[model samples]
Target: MPRTPRSRSLRWADVAAWRLRRHHLRGPLTAPEPWQAVKDVSAALCGLHAQVMSSAEQAVAARTRLPDAGAAVREALWERRALVKTWAMRGTLHLLPAHELHLYVAALRDDRRQMGDRLLAQQGLTPGDVAVVLEALPTALGEDRLTREALAERLTAVTHDRTIGEKVRSGWGVLLKPAARRGLLCFGPNDGRNVTFCAPRYRLGADDERAERSTPTDPAQALGAVLRRYLHAYGPASPDDFARWWGTGTPEVRAALSALGDAVTATDIEGHRSWALRDDVADMAPAPTGDGPLVRLLPAFDPYIVGPSRQLVSLLPHPALRSKVSRTAGWISPVLILDGMIGGVWKAQRRVRHTEVEIEAFVPLSSGVRRRIAEEAEGLLAPGDGHGITVRFA
Candidate 1:
């Protein structure tokens, strides 16, 4: 019989450790060896491809090894053609890594295309012209960064139009995406303003032309890989959670769950269902102790929170918490994760003295725990500059 995801006794420490290591300790993404970390945690973490970089001062105060980690993570985001947007899960922008990017985008491309097409039509671009422009991009961008103006020139040249401003901008997104997929280009270094697209180290040569382009194939194997990894990190979860995370329907989720029958087991949780990795539950490794030096203030859209299913209430149950996560408008608030499992919610503002962190908690923090949280927050913000940390009980 196919088992559904049910609740089980979860070790908060283990969960915290897993989340931390996956994000922080997996090593810097820019290191040629970033993929090593990806492959290492491949079985335990999924869909969290965005890299989180911290300011140089923040890294020094926090005493982290990968102070420039965020840049690496961003590169990882582009390398995989993972759309660097906030809409992957529940409208939170995440730097989704490559593989998951391909899958989700494949399923979503048409929906996006419709939206893109509608916008283009409004800008006076016809389907035939759109096709022609896309075909001209390679030659248009040949051996150059192809800034907006440069791209416009190329489009005007092809269309023989005195004014092709809207036409160029309209086809910009369409051409750039395919260019990225073909490994011909990607986002270059950020100049403190907008991120400009540039060519990758290696151009797409003729030898690569015949190979099948990347496709988001949700094979039973791939789905099984995703399910097993989730169970390993956030185990004893129900299919509903899986469905929500994958953004797929129940039948697809069921099939994916079925594919992992041998590697997982179901358990009961307060009349609910979840699944756990059979191996981890039986022989889960003990979390290394002795107060590790690492501490992180993960941004709101950080994968640790976003990758799991919608039933996050299992871990974070307050409705206010939900509101705080969304308050940023477009930016994700920084989360204070002392030892994982959301020690508290923190908001930061640029104050005259320094950055001010307004912290709210669901439980009353003891002096010792509060001290640790404060110390961690200090490391996160400017020195002695973070204050106004309030503690409220749920």
Candidate 2:
């Protein structure tokens, strides 16, 4: 495939560079402090899919110039209450900016799933049983956070249903995610190895945690707002892409994007119809020659890699090799990106004082590309920890 501009269409290369700029992936962001840098990256991508905490931290570190990336993530999440970690989009764990959590939740709470009912029935449970759990959540989750087992006990005691307790105890968020998406439940700080749950108000540290429910966000308006943000970050995309990323039905996403009307502009990318924020159409210039950010690495499940509407071309242009990136059991491999396309896959591990990285490229890498990959790997290190990296190709 010739990576060139098709006549009368937005240059895919230009779109790639523009998205890199939007994601702060073009280079390190210079911010006054750490949290600001972290928030900037998180906000740009809507939020970080924090299925793996280190991957989420590296997602920010690689894009921003932070002295101590890990500490900064902890401060926002644990100390400053600036970030909220919860089950978000597609029912996966995410680290969202505290201020923006409601926007995502507002859209999510309104989008009901038939899967929940089906799962409930499979467990011999009913909507009323789940409703009782939802209603009791306000009280069950108090000022202090409760572990899953602890919360299960409370729900079982309150609902007086031993079956529900067993289901909650045995399952991995199957019964609980409904309350989570409904804004009735969220993750609390760790209890050693045990994961805890609490009300969103409590984790956010609002006074009267139980009483401080946020004002309801209009689903239509909220969906509209989120769609605009998505288009800006991952535009030249379709509603189906957004639906896949957002874990919602295509019809709802299509309706929301249509509702945007003049706020969005339709365009073509490689002959496929896509839409972008109308105000941003002018900024979509053609890509300059030479590889842009030749060898950037994205950790597993990084938003740019897992994004529904992003790195476009229906999960990369190489449909033949899509299985390597989008693996089984919903695992997105840590990828090596060459000029905004999935060039290869890579993995890294910390070995005491040094970090070891192995790269397996789909096509041969030039000397220049190899050097850039080494530098990109070095950037993943923590400051003042004797930053040393060993790069190997497999």
What are the lDDT scores of the predictions, listed in order?
Answer: 0.49, 0.76
Instruction: Point out where model 1 deviates above 4 Å.
Output: 1-143, 152-185, 198-243, 246-250, 267-271, 283-296, 327-332, 351-353, 382-394
TM-score of 1: 0.62
**TM-scores for all predictions:** 0.62, 0.90
Cα lDDT tens digits for candidate 2, 231-331: 88888677877888888888888888877877777778767677788788788874454663456888888888777534434436466777788789988
Each model's total of backbone clashes:
14, 0
210-258, model 1: which lDDT tens digit per residue?
2214443445555566567666666556777766665556676677777
Off by over 4 Å in 2: 1-8, 122-124, 205-216, 286-293, 309-317
- lDDT at 172, model 1: 49
